[model samples]
Target: MTARVDSAPADSQAEAFKRLYPDQYYRRFLSQNTRPDGRSLTQTRPASVVLGVITSADSSALIKIGNTTVIAGVKLEVLMPKDPPDQGCLQVNVELTTLCSPEMRDNRPTEVPSFLTQQVDAAVRGSSAWQPQALCIQAGRAAWAVYLDLYVLCADGVLLDACVLAAMAALNALRLAPVDVTDAGNVVAAGNDAMTDGTSHPQQPYALSKQGTPLTLTCAVIDDRLIADPSSEEESLAATVVSTTVDGQGHVMGLQHAGGGVELSTAHLQQCITAAQDRHTDLFRVLSSAQPPDH
Candidate 1:
């Protein structure tokens, strides 16, 4: 009888190799205080933003960090809140399409999208990024609900940070048409006379306080080395990942930690916060310089 040999399944083989070698592979670069992509441990990738990408939306922006791309669109709707008669509402949704990554499926439910949406909601709400009252056209009668939809066109890593950036940029570019409150308590679009120009006029929209704008920075811990804005491969090999958000004035807005490998120290947490603060200036500059897309 001939001896029979069984080979490991392809999936299992890949997983086994990742389990065995990724740490060593990453460590070789970490020992030099650098990443395989030639970035220093605390370095972040280049980022860019383009505004007014979607003509249909009240406002839209696309942001890219490294190869990760995210687009955010804002749609304004009139609605009355039941309990909060005085304040308006902001609803945020995030979607990762299959075109971005094989891990995501078309129209399939996933926790990641929901989690990202909630994270962005909390970040904006927790900070003074937007005043809900500004969206309220009439107390208890009618108010503008801003719906922010974020789509991930590419996923290199740092999904949450990218989403938040896109949302902020889109909101900054928003220009709302003036509305008139009728005697019947109906919200109607203002006439062309509302604007000095006869052409499709743009009105000064509800704007977010620039000083209150929030920026998020993500750090990955590998072999006790803290790396900022890790790539997808680095994230997979990380022992723990921490995401921290800071406002323009350097106040911590939100902090989140994931992965099960390592326990983070208070000192390390402070380092992450400091790094996020340092990144705020550069991020704000990028957002400010972002030009509206040419028609």
Candidate 2:
């Protein structure tokens, strides 16, 4: 659950209530008829996605859902793990920079990163996007682990939605160099931990596993109005709900509710799903059309 702002406050106390306990007000909206943005129960906000924004990364993308913007980078590395030799792990991290929002500060670790990263890790692990066998070396002695890093360059609303979309696009644009393994099973790559040893190794590049159909889509609520993407101001005013759904695939990768007043009904939930299905064309188009940076 992310945050939200309730529209059509009934009174001054209700307005204050929307502030003091937005989650509760958000719930009231869901139970009532209208949403905060004056949208139908099934409407989603506007969204746009850009690919290969970072020239230096192996793969990168920027996605803006409403006013929320997220940047994602994916880097590939070979390593030896103490456990699960046959399975390559996916690691994700999030950094909410100060430029994203005034609420985020230079003080302690921001809550957005911890929450968004957890969702990303779960989504990648649960989806059939990556195969551990593809990352295997000699049936378990070594493997390759992919790290996906996300940075909140800006945050208007629905950080999870933008981050997840950017992450998928970045992964699709990723290209890993060749891996060399001798008969002795000694694997090698001509690079340091940063992959900048500057020595080119002779090996053929292999494609990664096929990405799962229909990536997850996130929808937040600003009261009864179930906005496909909410901006930061909208988030600040209501109780927010983030539902991660893989349309057509119909898998609920993740679901989180944040804020104070959002009350969702079963009917509203169904409406959100319908909205996500409608957005799939745009989402998949952005994911598949994303181009990788030239190395």
| Candidate 2 residue-wise lDDT, 145-191, digit = tens | 78899998878767777777777777767666665555565677533
lDDT of 1 by residue, 45-137 (tens): 999999998899989999999999999999999988667897878899998978887677565777989889999999878877577877777
lDDT of each: 0.84, 0.67
Question: TM-score per candidate, in order?
Answer: 0.86, 0.74
Model 2, position 138: C-alpha lDDT score: 42
Q: After TM-score superposition, what is the CA distance of residue 176 in candidate 1 from its true location, in Å? A: 2.1
Which prediction has the highest TM-score against the true structure?
1
Stretches of model 2 off by over 4 angstroms after superposition: 1-46, 182-186, 189-203, 213-216
Clashing pairs in 1: none
lDDT of prediction 1: 0.84
